[model samples]
Target: MSTAASTEACSTSRRMSIGMLYVDLGIVTRPQLFEALVECARTRCTLPAALASLGYL
Candidate 1:
């Protein structure tokens, strides 16, 4: 893989881990995580910021 691809993969993996951490900690459900992800994408914000905007945090 190219260096760019490898970096992208690592970034994606890290993002998923953070999402799962929220679920594992009981801070959010899987569905809620999905919602937060959507919100994050929509607003181009971080997960924690998205959660805060959605009143989860």
Candidate 2:
């Protein structure tokens, strides 16, 4: 892959890992994580910020 594509892939993988970690640790439910992801995309915010906004953080 191109350098930019590789970097983007790595970033996406890392973000997915973090979200899964939260679920694994019982910090958030899978559905909550899904909602946070949607909020993250809609608000252009990070996952943590989205979680906090959703009163999960």
lDDT of each: 0.83, 0.87
Tens-place lDDT digits, model 1, residues 1-57: 999889766765776789999999999998888898888767767888888898888
For model 2 the TM-score comes to: 0.76
What's the true lDDT of residue 46 in model 1? 81
Deviation in Å, model 1, residue 42 alpha carbon: 1.1
lDDT of 2 by residue, 1-57 (tens): 899889766765776789999999999999999998888768867889899999999
After superposing candidate 1 on the true structure, give the runs of residues whose Cα lies further than 4 Å from its correct spot.
1-12
Error of 1 at 27 (Å): 0.7
| TM-score for candidate 1 | 0.74
